[model samples]
Target chain A: MLIGFVWLSLTKAGVPLDFSFLKDFSKRLGDGFWLTVALSLASLACSLLIGVACAAGQSAKILPLRYLCNIYVGLIRGTPLIMQIYLFFYIVGTAWGIENRFAAGVIILSVFEGAYITEIIRGSLLSIEAAQIEAAKAVGFTGRQTVRYVVLPQMVARTLPALTGQFASIIKDSSLLSIIAVTELTQTIREISATNFRLFECYFTLGVLYLCLTLPISFVSKWLERRYDYGN
Target chain B: MEIEFRSLSKQFEDHKDVLLPMDFAGDVHALAVIGPSGGGKSTLLRILGGLIAPTAGQVWIGGEKVCYEGAAVEAHRKKIGYVFQLGGLFKHMSAIDNIVTPLIRVHGFSKEQARARADELLGRFGLLTEANKKPAALSGGQQQRVAIARAISAKPKLLLLDEPTSALDPEYTTEVLGIIRELKEERLDFVIVTHEMGFARHACEKVLFLAEGQLLEYGDSDTIFQQPATYKLRSFLGKLLEWNI
Candidate 1:
């Protein structure tokens, strides 16, 4: 009801709502949508690997390794993703010969998202009560066994929902990669609007398409939280 | 099990001394450590379990000095079981798996052996039907019972309980206390930190009254409850039992 009212009012106010351009651009938009999904999935996998490693490093006994993880998280979180993307792609990426825009975008998104994932994992691990670890020790579990049985299970239960929700953030954040001309959903919309001058229609369709990707992920996140709602 | 604390003290980096210097020794099947909050009862129990190293002195259990360094500490921990106030069962695992996994993984029991042992403990504790439930599905009392069962499943020589029933309602407290009392019949040695005055007096053979990081009174259960040597003990017991039914 609200969306109909808003769309009708905007159309009556001379905001052209011509979605006819979609017929011509439908195939490109579809490809862009799939590209975003693929990018998010690949980054999700990479970020999880990076996040787990960094989280473990943050808790390592070696001071330098712990410091390195702290510094990585601190730097990523302290700066904006846009700035990081620009600097990493233009400066670090070029210097390191990471030339493929798609690969560069994946690397940037993974690094950016990995820091947050690391915090999600570390926070979950920390939330596992000291009593739990102590109980494992009391039962003669080696440090590895304790982590494997007690720490990891509880951590996964605690972090999985948050981590799943983060995929939505990844999909949305991947839109920013359009600035570097990655030809993702947002970039495709930006290109279509530039040619057709249907900025409102194009952006609205973009929002709807992004929601199409994210809403189900949001549902899955909620479902995971309910499924893993163990002894809180 | 026998316990000895020789100038055993624990001071955090902030210099708050949780346990003051103390020297005491007792050999008993059931020893209860009772104290007011922040009185170092839990810390003393942790030291005995080899969970933490005391700052200054030494602990001896079963005639062997408890080592807190390297492989020796792990060895010391292997022979001891501990139950926490929160039950501390792995929340994600079913009750039976909580007991079985540790037996198989840490104690090197074969899967069959671990399953059989877990089943035996679950049956003995009357938790056979709830064996498939996770800790979240169990009651406070049942969770603590599972924790106790898991603690003893590997047949540790000593079990240290840190106020196992403190978080429970009266009914659950009774349920958990009953299980602890039954441990005595099995001849499994245990040191429990408790606020249950009656259990300390009746179920345990020895009592150590601690207050403000000091062992204010130590004696056989009957003697300590009946003839507290210090005013501290007398008043502590009086305040704790003032409104008892």
Candidate 2:
């Protein structure tokens, strides 16, 4: 295949197909690896909270609250995530004088991913039948009770697969933080390749690391999709 | 319990009224609303169920004005159960979950109690084997049975069924109707909207004929079918009887 030919040619051209760079880079990557995982986990948690909150706000009866949520979601979704990150970092560091790049990355990723997750949650909520809500109301459930007990359980069950897939996407997207010198996996690999001129080995190791993180999530997502598919 | 609809009217913007102004009441075990499609039969049943507000006049439940025009209509709706045309079981839940949801969520029953109640009702409806299955996996008749079991799980005083058998095949229709007939024997009050005159005749104590948002005739099943009061009812019966003839 053409791919095999290219790969072999690249290996022969001193591209360092061996993955020995990963061990060397792992030492240099050091604190950054833990930092990157912490940043991703923190941002993902914030994203879920903000996403669920904004979804509930959007579905509120008050026009002003719903409109505000809509505008927030639109503004976040319309702009590129890279630009949003740069803007947040610049504004927070200069105007607010917040020196922490890690915090800035977490905040930016949360707001960005929150908008996408909000849409997913809202779609799942709306997919529930109107009759079910009516039946709940008929049985004397208050608006809050209906949503908390009746609607939310079904929404969570329906959207779990999509949420897991989104989490995987968020993990991949966390690599973008390297643009701000956050020294994540991608940045560490790039630094290693720049020093030893082992581009293929470094990138290959990075891809494997990403696979290690995302493949498990992908499998879990598929399993959840099968489990939640009440249609079966 | 007695319920009355007094001069109730409802209309959508730029559309003719779906329910014309009319006064009707029921103080019986079972009543059937029978008519051609889009004749406001469902609209009337909805008003009685307190799902939507009427554009004019009021509805009284147990001699209290529970619903009025342009007002928040809050009533003891738990006493009334409405079955939509196609079972309308929650697609996300298994049959037992669907049956137990209203009890646990609305009535604040403990999960153990709700599950016990669901099992009892599913057993009564002969759906214990299918209780773990979702509505989408069940046959039409089984889904409808689950829907009915869900509706009655709250032990409603009044049950309203909107074309419960409309989506089923003849065999399934008979199966579902047989379930309803059995419920009637247990003294459950029902307001059924049906096209099956045969079931109406055999099962309902009274039948009301509706046409173009107006009540055309009301009488016991035999009299309404054999000696229709109006030309509208006569033509309606003629059309329906022709199907059987």
Candidate 3:
């Protein structure tokens, strides 16, 4: 009833409940939407790589490497993600003189998501019993080989659900890239609302689009989770 | 075929010496270490498995000094198979996959070959029906079988089991012990740390009684059980005999 009342009030106030702006916004948000997807996909890939590497480093036997990884995780996790994005954007564009907002956006998202992924991966790695490592070692596996083959396969399998959820989070968080004017879906909706004075419609359409993208991811993640649940 | 430990001692910073200085040499195919809890039997097994270093000693596997200070112990571990007290099957893998993991990963067998070998091993262990089942779905005995199958898949010369059947019910324990006994007939060398004196007496060629991390007695099973040489061994046997009876 509350949602209906709100919808009626907005429609009666000439807020334009129709999704006609989607077509117009699609034209303006075209290249930017593709760029956003590209940036998100690229960033997700890089973050996964960084996260796995960091997790491995954290789990490493060497003291310095583990300490460094711990510090990295702590710093990233302690601060707000918005601050991290702003810091990375400013550092990359001004200090590093990287003119491409696309590059800056990708780098920012990758590092931001990488920190969270590292924790998830580390948790997954440590979830494995120490006995498994011993068994692998006993079977002629060097430490490196044991981790690469025995530990990693199990880790990836165990953490796939959490990792995919993290990936979806990265995609949603890509909206923050609009601060630097990367013109992703959120930015496109904002531009459309500003031009057509249809804030409600624009946001609703954007929400639908996000739902479309993320709902499948949620379902796929759930399915993958079931499939990969080897313990069951 | 031979293992020699010279003045082996393991001391943790927090605890007293877990393994007291001990010298032992053996050429037997199957040796069982039996002792009460906190006897450092697992520590001794780990040292033999090359998972840890001894504080002051050397472990020679087949006459090669494998556990010297600052040595790459992993090389020595290549010749041994160590099963933990639990089955320690990889939770994320099916029984077949768990059996073949080390084979494909460490031995570099092709995927097809590894699968076939894993099937053969699991089939031999009566786990073919549960090949696709994960460790969580399998019974404790089944998981232990998978672990043993995985351990022996690499065909190591020496097998080290730390209380392999301690976690199982009597029936499952018997099943696992029967499998180990069968493996022994294949000429696989074994060092089993067990609480089951009956299995030890029947399956092991020799038994080493450990007390407070010290070797109290080392002899053939008949001699160790029937005529313990030391006071500690006598008391340990007395306790076990009372429990069993």
Candidate 4:
């Protein structure tokens, strides 16, 4: 009710809440929407791999490995995603021969988000009690068995909610890939607005489309939080 | 079980001695270490359990010198069962899985074999109905019982229980102590660090009284409680029993 009232007032106040471009540009919008979903999923999988390795590396006995993980997390978290996207795409991508925009976008997004996932995993790992580890040890659990039976189960419950929430950030962050002409949802909307001069309608529709993807993700994250709570 | 501490000591990074240089020997089925807090009871237990390496000393259990070296320490730990005060059941798993998982993963039991063992143990402990419940869903007594079951599932030569009933209420404490008493009846050798002086006196054969990181007294449970030699033990016992109902 409140959202409808706000939309009605905005339309009356000359905001031009026109969505007529939906008729002709719907197919392109749908394609862009699906692309964003694919990019987010592909990035999620890659980032998860990077996240787990780096999280383990953060506690590695080798000093250089620990320092390298620390530096990666610090550098990524300390800088802006836009700066990273530009530098990686232009300089590193060219040198590495990563010219495909979609592939480049996935790599960039994965690298950008992997730092956050690393922290999430590390935090969950640390949250496991020392006594639990000791108990496992006392019972003859090999270090690997302790990790497999004791640490990982608790980690999944602790990290599932944060990981799903990170997926939402990935979807929103993938929009910045439009700057490099990856032709995702935001880029598609920008092109439609540039041709038809329907900036408000195009951006508004883009938000609703992104919402259509991320809103369900948010609900799923909340549901997972409850589902995996296990009374811990 | 025969245990001998050859100058066993533990000092943390802050240079604080958690367990001062100590020498003691005992051969008993159930040995209880009772003392005030910060008296190094748990530290001594951990060192025996191979959960922590001692600063400068050796522990010999059952004619084998406890080794602190890499593979030797793992081998030492594999033959001992240790239970904590809080009953550290893996919270994510059900009570049955909590037992079965360690049996299958750590002890290399087949899935069917592990489940059968878990079921029999849970039933023996009167927890068969609650086997499927998670630790958080079970009572404090049940959780500790499951921890004990998991601890003994591999048939260790010795058990180290570090105040296993301390975290429980009076009713639940009795429920757990009952199980520990049963372990005594079965002649399973174990060491317990407990504040329950009554259980220590009654169920335990030998008692070691520790205070301020030192072994103040160590002797038979009957003689120690009835006739404490050290002033610290008397005063400790005095204060403990002073508020008893």
Give TM-scores for every candidate, taking all chains together and pairing residue i with residue i: 0.90, 0.90, 0.87, 0.93
Better of 1 and 2 by DockQ: 1
Candidate 1 lDDT score at position A13? 95
lDDT of 4 at A129: 89
The better candidate by DockQ, 2 or 3, is 3
True contacts kept of each: 0.81, 0.54, 0.79, 0.83
Q: Is candidate 1 or candidate 3 better by lDDT?
A: 1
Candidate 3 residues A20-133, lDDT tens each?
656755676666567667888999999989998998898799999999989988998888878977877787568879878888888888888899999888888678877777
- Model 3: per-residue lDDT, tens digit, B82-201? 788784776767888776767777677898989988888888998899998888899899889988988888788788999989999999999999999999999999999999998888
Relative to the true structure, candidate 2 reaches a TM of 0.90
User: How far in Å is the alpha carbon of B82 misplaced in model 4?
Assistant: 1.8
lDDT of 4 at B122: 94
lDDT measured at residue B103 in model 1 versus the true structure, 0 to 100? 86
lDDT (C-alpha) at residue B203 in model 2: 93
Highest TM-score scorer: 4
**Top DockQ hit:** 4
Candidate 2 segments exceeding 4 Å error: A1-16, A60-68, B13-16, B62-75, B104-116
Whole-model lDDT per candidate: 0.91, 0.83, 0.83, 0.91
